[model samples]
Target: MEKKSIQNTLLMGFIEDIKLRYKTGNIVEKFIFINIGVFIASLLFKVIFGLYKTNGDFIFNWFALEHNFSTLITKPWSIISYGFLHAGFIHILFNMIALYYIGNLFIQYFTQKQLVQFYVLGTFFGGLLFMLSNSYFPLFEGTRPHLVGASAGISAIFIGLTTYMPNYQLQIRFIGFVKLWHLAAIWIGLDVIGLVGSNAGGHFSHLGGALFGFLYVNQAANTKLNIWDKLSGIFTSRKKPLHTVYKSSKKTAPKSKNTDLTQQQIDGILDKISKSGYDSLTKSEKEFLFKQGKK
Candidate 1:
């Protein structure tokens, strides 16, 4: 009875620990868990189908992105669904590794919500590009390749971070320190070269994802967006700022104190950035800055 009780306690503890970790984990960790869970579920389904002497790939076929337009129309969710699936152990392993590092770095400078936007949108664009390649390119005439993997999403996070901080240095193993843009260049360069290779569709998807990341970060940082301003100015040519000449000292007194406090906090954060660097700021500090920037 004692031995059985001990075993049961240990098993419950292990299960509880996993549950706790998942609950406390950030969005990146949650994504990793989801991917691993999907991979294992796929394996289990494959084994079960094999035991019955039947094809197991039908399950994957339903979820994986089909290159054919007619087939894709039937399973539209596969564009995002395929990002959570993987072809093999090595595929998921590398993708999860890249996501973990790049995603963690990404959250430091951007919000978790923005990360999700980049990842999902990247996957969407990548899948579209993959389908387009199959339809237009003669090389894929005889092939019916299905897209599955988190590489497109990971590529977006990687390239997005690189774009946001091109000069950020990372100490690589045996490669010393390398600039973020340098690594991004190599990443895109390989994909570009792979266009003629067997995995040309995969490369196309990667480039599509990288392109989104680059364009998004560039547009965000483009302060002198004169064309956009000009277009908006044309539309709002007659609009003028509303002014309030009336004063309410009682209402304004408390607001001024709050505004001063917020400004002091912002000043403190700016000073910290100057002393250490943007990366040195804590998560809360970074979030505060991010919120302020939106305003």
Candidate 2:
């Protein structure tokens, strides 16, 4: 009875620890936890099916993105759902690793909501391209393949970050420091070369996600053409301005002087980070950027 009680206590403690981590973790950590949880659940289902000598893959059948347009119409949720599913341990392992690193870096610059948008939209675009390629391309003719994995969403985040900070340097253990865009180019090149391979559909989906990431970053880089602002304007109520009242120069002078940081200063700091990496910033610059990120 004592041994059983101890085991129960340990299990409860472990579960509570996980809950605590999930609650306080950043967006990247939360995503990694979710992918791991989903993967474990999928493995459990597979084992149960195997135990019963059942050949049916109920989970993948319903959640994985189908190649056929008709099947997709019936199971629209699969478009985004497929990104959360994985075919094997090795598949999810590498994907989650990539997502963890890239996503953490992404979150340092962008908001959590923007990361979610990139992931979901990237997955949607990837699934769409997968189905379209299967439908129109001669290469995919007479073959039906379902897509699964978080690679598409990860690719979106990866490519999007690369587009924003192309010169950013990432130190690889054995490879030294490599430019972000260099890695992104190689990533896309590999997918392009994989089009004729067995996992052609997967490659197509990756490219689709990368394309969205690239386009999104490019569009967002232009502040005047921000899509988010335009979309928000549609839902936001506007009212005509009242007559402007001039403030005394004497009162405004001290207020302007009190503002230590300006938009131009922030822009210059961002440009420095882009060219020389975040570590290039001095203590004060880093602190400023960190404080700005919090706001």
TM-score per candidate: 0.76, 0.84
Query: What C-alpha lDDT does candidate 1 achieve relative to the native structure?
Result: 0.78
Residue lDDT tens for model 1, 163-238: 6567777778998878888899999999999999989999989988887776665555223222233332423335
Task: Please report the candidate that would top TM-score against the real structure.
Answer: 2
Cand. 2 Cα-lDDT: 0.81
Give the worst 10-residue stretch by lDDT in candidate 2: 240-249
Best by lDDT: 2
lDDT per residue for candidate 2 within 149-208, as digits (tens), equals 998999988998897789988899999999999999999999999999999999999999
lDDT of 2 at 107: 73
* TM-score of candidate 2 versus the correct structure, residues matched by position: 0.84
